[model samples]
Target: MICLYIGTNTGSCGLITAQKDPVPLKSVEVELEVRDHVATVVSTLNYENKEDKPLEAVFVLPLPGDAAVCHFSAQIGQTQIVAEVKEKQKAREEYDDALSSGQQVCLLTESDESPDIFSLCVGSLPPGESASIRLEYVTELAVQADDGLRFCLPAVLNPRYQPQGSAGAGFQVTSVPASLEPYSLSFSARVSSPRPVSKVESNCSLDPLQYLNTDQTQATVKLAAGHKFDRDVELLIYYKDAHQPTAVVEAGQASAEPGSLMGDPVVMVSLYPEFPQSVMSSTASCGEFVFLMDRSGSMGFRIKRRSLQTCIHSAKDTLLLLLKSLPMGCYFNIYSFGSRYEHIFPKSVEYSRQTMEEALKKVKKMKADLGETEILEPLKHIYSQPCILNQPRQLFVLTRGWVKNDKEVIDLVKKNSSSHRCFSFGTGENTSYIFINKISKEGGGHAQFITATDKIQPKVMQSLQFALQPSVIDISVTWDLPKEVSVTVLTPPITSILQGQRSLIYAQLTGQSSEAAEGCVTLKYSLAGHPSENQLHFSLRPAEDTGLTVHMLAARTLIRSLEMEARDNKGERDEEMKKVVEELSIQSGVSSAFTAFIAVSKSSGEAIQGPLIPPPSDFWHISAALLGQAQNYHDIHVCNFLITATESELSVKDPLLQLVSLLEASGCWLLKPALASVLGKTSKEVANLKPASASSEVWATILALIWLHGFKMDAKDEWELLAMKAASWLRAHNATCVTECVEAGNALLGCRVTKDALGL
Candidate 1:
């Protein structure tokens, strides 16, 4: 007698019987065939000995299709018993194969064999075991397209034994290449296992025009996996519209024809993210400069052991260089402001080698005093000065955004527009955009917000370049268009179009012209009593879409400007700015503002602390949310969050702390000594409120320490004493603390911290 037992889920099957001398089978074979969507599998076992010895034999079959049948017979002492076993190999194989071929593959396996479609049989075998049989097949790629092209591959697997749903078996699309034809690319695949029912659909077309560049020189294609298998393939190509150019060329070449002029000229102006160094250098020498610095009580904040002293030194160094570089006859003056305004040097010192050095020395010797930030008083006083009364001068105002009567200062700047231009620089996150923008607009200049002290030199140089360039210039464009056709031009204000440099111009045209109509556009610019013009033309055709990409490039430039502006005004809110940012985000599809918002919103109001550490995600949310708030007061809280978050994120060893220290130094220069004194008290109170053993509160303590240290004077005053205490605490607690922080602390303390001490 022969008996068989199988553990289906565990894949363990065995045979048992009562036999004396039964010969073993050498091999077991299973074959599966599918016709008209129906499949069947047959198993056969061959044994060497056929004597009636009650032999027990066991056979394993491979599954290929979704449904299958297993038939077997048992021989027991000259008696034969036959039975059937239902299998799901065919269905499973088809699903797996489809997936491998990059087609959608789905499989559902069941543990119980309830229906009697499969067979269970056993026979006695006496000899050696036979090798197990396995099945394999290849998968094909499936392509689909309606609006766009999609390539898919299917996966293949054996049917006799259904795999677990999570089993690592499936198809993947290996490659999709661009097609030579103008329409679409085709997909090909390879399969791992053979399935009875497999199908490949042809004549699928993907829209190639959708992926083509505006100039039709290049196209992009995407490939994806289907079910179970993966294979790589090449793309086919077909060209359409032979008139289209095959490559990108300079604007003055064949690419700049009348039809191409509809788009803005693409110029390789910058290789990096920053403005050109040459532009900064050349622009810095165009005009004269007058330095207006604040020396109020709030300016007593110590940075690197000197309160505002390092900033003064830095400014003096920049001025010395500027004076040396200025053209003959250019003039400047040094003015310091507190509750009152006073000229450190004469009202207007003619630019010369010796006078520049003398002025720099005088700037270095100046000191901060206890007084309110009366910003407008200095401007009014300068306007009244006889030496500057008639001369055109650029006023460089450096201060913290804590001025009383800011509106008066703005009005005075507006009243003196023809004779003066004001470039305002603020050191901390507390810089008021409202005041900066107002002064800049009224004085016909630009505002610069410097959060990092070290970056101030470069930023000031850039601003000076813009100021030196001609302010009043005109640009005129004349283009040929169909009658009633409309057009619009977009570009940055140009003081003058430089020779050998590309000037960008954006224009949009509408209304029907004759098919393939051509016209010319002339651009004339007037600058400093000189005039120049350039002409470009375009050929127009009526189509669902035109091949103009100039707007895209122009939009990118605008977006770049807006992003810089947003970062500069880090702690302020302006509706006009918000609108610009949103527009840029929509146009570019890359929104730093939106990403920042998402990052912050996810934090759920957690205080993000940074510097030597990375804060939790929630801290980012609160910081972004507070930064975006409309009120300045609320935004100040956001700056606090950022400062705290930085401390938490960075260790004393982090190099980024050096940047923070520089910013702290600049803040000392901008803030009045009196305000610094008050902030110190507030910071101390906040530190005292925190409980002991709270490592989380360390960021707050650090901020308080910085605030107190920032207001200390160089003399042996209470603030100086507090600053020393804070510096000692930082050095003791933060192992990564370096000499830079110590120097910054000293600078904030109004000490003569040198550039060498700052490692600048």
Candidate 2:
């Protein structure tokens, strides 16, 4: 789909396939500025035409799914042309007309099939001439499981797999390997937060963090000496108090007419709800848990360039932890998909000793042998199943998220959202964040990502806790503004509220108000029949030097809502909604699926007159092969190179996971050899250390709890609930020598945990 056209010296203009020999794009430079949870990114792309004649290059790149592209411009010599947003069809026509008349022009538009993919066309470049294109966009950073705000700049656009007979299936692209890529990248970031900045980490090499202020609230970091476009550029920013609620009121743009989305003031409110301890202490005992796993070839690919561990390996480990942590009396099932789908159970099965063992046995054998990524069919199957009475449905989807049918998949989830909650996990460096985020957002659940540098256990366990929490009801938001002022909410209604989860609300203030006035917004919800409220009172005066990031993000939110409505509406309504979306996109100068940014240069000296250049003889052959195979650039097989563990790796196990694996379905551990092995002792030694009056299962459970509290305290977020389950089981058994067992267990495991700490 991405091609470049270079005219011949003989004045022949023709469509030519992209050849790696002399690509026009030379280098890319990016600057990221983060304020609290929002980020603004500016990128400069340098291009040079080395051919004898004029060149036209088309490149398709990836962006964050939720990014609001706000600026586009091109600099040629002394003149700079700023692009304007227009209806997509009209913009394309204008770009073509300019090209025909030999005036240099450029066009940028979102992909029709996916929001994350964008195409840029630069035409009629003069021979040996250079151009610098500047692009700017704004996006909200995602909060991670470890309280780090995540910002990802996709450096690689992996080929999306289009299923047979799907839309855009024939649009094949030629991708040069990372090693052969003819471009360089440089990235820098500046971060500021209301709370003091704690630290910043990345998977790639980076310069040391430099604090800019006394309070450590502002800092800057950049990529180290040499950088390549081989993988995504990711940053994880930690703050001293990440869970605090905050609000930003940004003044509207001054140049635009009043009453428009861009011209009016906008406020972004961020809330991290904290549930009461009384409600949190009791976990749900009944639910239908369905886990959908992606087994496509891409799953065999490593999560990081330097790591030998593949995505499937980490995913399997996460699944093991999840299965072991489920509460009793719950119903569960597992589904794996590639080109085809398979389920371990014909239907949801109740949680019991036999069922748990059976599922774990089957899970250990799962492999990434499937052909391609096709998730829609399995989702449909899961939705069609009958919901159990009094037991809620909680779906967990794990995948690389590499598919072209993003809209279809998201629409399906939206339609069936009321029946269940969907928690999505994107597990590789090159995941389709748009796909992962949309499904979860629409299904009234949360989305999590697991990269090579991230620990998957904590993230998955957090989602499981969300699944077990009682559903929040009676959700409402109230705004208190000046009598002369009013508001219009741009974000969708709040439906799902979880403990320690950040929820964002964007609203537009249209009416005039005093500069010194203040406004208050309150969020109310009920958990387990208990009412709760959180309110934020912010100044009516707008914040300075915001660069309209909040307004653009708000406009993007409204446009996405309208676009989804257009898809769901009938012919006339759909047309009406499309018009509204296009008008708003153009008014706000934000790029959307229905609109594009176009700029034309009138200073090109002469018209380019040439016949079309013909592509090389091998172009057709290569295109055909890539199209037939779906061209999944990340689809690799896990072979000898990916397995770095020694043959005896199984013998030296993760003591925590080993101890967890020894727990029974009843949440008690038997005094077995595996338990002794996990405790770093022989079975005879452990048996001799047990209290004389304590039962075998009770002693084994106490030892496991002591070891977790003493050694694995760092991973408490992952094992805390399981330990609770074990404690509850021990209390129900009512074994004798309760204090003696605690003392003896601590002595045997070299732990100093008190009986009270275990909630005995």
Candidate 3:
């Protein structure tokens, strides 16, 4: 007989066997197993008594309701039997309750060919022995917004005895909309075993600038993935007028693809405006005139021994033209100066052919005396005369060079702007023409350098025209704009336009206009009759919708205009040029890469070859020719040549030397540097033929020797030879210091000895 002991408890349940009872005793054990999506258990039993006795037992375990029907198998003797049954109805009830409360479901595949379903299983073991069983089934899943519908795949624990445990199965249900067309987007979904999946839809819109100006503008829109997107977009453009329909033009576009590392997209729009062609003309008139000429000792120096005949001829010709063109009511006087001022034309004369002819004859007979050029005394003398101030007057000054008192003359001119316009004519190589030009600008007038005797007539006419043109005598603007609002005029005043010429005023405005009710600008001017004024109204809103983009476009435009104007020689000011150069320099912190200097060449129709090297002989001759044509030969032509020849290797001899001689005879010291640079490197033979110490040539040679010593070149023997020659020449003249010459010679000898020791 066999006896079995059974114990049932909530936490622990088992069967025990009792021994020595004349009956077979048996014990059974059960174990449960659980995985990612399924759970299962197995049972075994053992017999402890020798006498075999029949054993009976019952097994129970929790089951998942969604699981498929449970299958049971038993191995007894050599026979095997399998039974299948549905899971406990109570498990289903529990699952239904949990699902109703928003719990998720897990489903498994019954087999490779089956869909996902619920599954469960149970089995028994023979007495006093161990056996394996198989349970194959599927699981059911629940669906929710967050919890997508899915199934678990069935897996096998023991292939030979227990062929199936649970099959792997998964399905994805998208909670996001399939296509978000209204929002311009699309959606998709996917699943990797054991989890639910979902996705949101998105897309780019075709018409980007839906709200843009329809008549004159169009745009396109694009979409990207990041929180911040950066891309270059294109814009289609059109033009519209109040009376006409819009005309479309295809504009270019840029693209920013997905996953691009660069951030943010930029949109660029271009617009065109219709502008009328500009035509310009000018006329100049003089009511009263004063001619101030420099008659310093230097002027006595002759060009080709003709006493600046070319210059005098040009001046006479210019004066003749002015006198002939002067209205019959006009009057003029002539004043010449050197160490002191003198009245060349003793009294002012009314314009007449006879008067003019006599004045021309008088000018021809005039000669410059050798005296220091002091410009102040003559200018003061004219300024002190109250009779000239009763009516509008003009001052015409001619000079071969600048005096230290130039600033004083400029100041006086500035003070006299109410009654006078001061025009300056720079004549020769030694003259500070640049300074003269600056002074003229400051004095509300113009400056012209006479490059040749021939240029004098045209230049005078131009200067006169500039002086006579009626311009904006004064400009004033009044606006009722919000406090702190800023306004700037974009166009400069046109001073050379005719008194009645129509002109336009353009300005840019910034800041809010709401604070003030209205805004207006007042422009005051002087015309032929009398003073006049004009008014302009300001817009209530800002001129530009996008400040940054407009500013960038403006800057680019300005830069291009500036570069173009810098290369143009027609004497026109391009408002955009300086602003562009300055802005670029400020932003990039770089010095200007190139400096512009006017270079006219013989090859006028073709580009000049080589870098802009200093002017050669051809340049000097051409420049001289231009000057002569202007009738400013004695003064302006020589000045232009000196400035052009400075630091040039070609300036070392011949024409340059001759030019320097002319300048020195005019008492011009400005050309000393160029002469020094040339003579410093010339051979001893060349140095010996140079003028003696008492001559200005000697001063140039001394300065040259000083420069050579300062440079300290490697050719010691060559420098010594030049130095010995200079010393000998200096000793031949009582004008030079022997001690200084000896010191310089000793220094050269020492350098030669040092170089010889170094085998150089």
The C-alpha lDDT values of all candidates are 0.36, 0.81, 0.35
The ten-residue window of minimal lDDT in model 1 covers 596-605
Q: Where in model 1 is the C-alpha error above 4 Å?
A: 1-288, 296-317, 367-372, 385-391, 400-415, 424-438, 446-457, 462-482, 487-523, 527-529, 534-760
lDDT value, candidate 3, whole model: 0.35
Residue runs of model 3 more than 4 Å from their true location after superposition = 1-286, 297-310, 388-390, 428-431, 467-472, 477-485, 488-524, 530-760
Return whichever of 2 and 3 wins on TM-score: 2
The TM-scores, one per candidate, come to: 0.33, 0.93, 0.31
Provide the RMSD of all predictions against the true structure, rounded to 1 decimal: 29.4, 4.3, 43.3
Write the residue-wise lDDT of candidate 1 on 137-178 in tens digits.
111111111101111111111011111232221111000111
- Best-to-worst ranking by TM-score: 2, 1, 3
Q: After superposing candidate 2, which stretches have Cα over 4 Å from the reference?
A: 1-22, 170-177, 571-573, 605-653
**Model 1 CA lDDT for position 248:** 16
Question: What's model 2's TM-score?
Answer: 0.93
Candidate scoring better on lDDT of 1 and 2:
2
Better by TM-score, candidate 2 or 1: 2
Q: 1-760 in candidate 3: lDDT tens per residue?
A: 1111121121111112234232221322333222111223233332232323222221111122223222334433344444322122322343233223322211111211111111211111123433333333222221111112222121111000001121211110101111210112111111111211122111122222232233323222222322111111111122122111111111111242221111111112111111111211223333677777766644543211212333333344445544443544467778877766787566676655566566656765655552556676677777777654444677788775434334345556666666667777765322343346545654566666553443344556566654555433544433344464454443343332222222333333444335233455554555554555555444343332222222222223333335435545253434456445544423321112111111111111122122221111122222223221232123221321121111222222332222222222111222244453454433453334344433554444444444445444433322332343343444445445333433343343332222122111
Report the Cα lDDT for candidate 2. 0.81
Residue 78 lDDT in candidate 2: 64
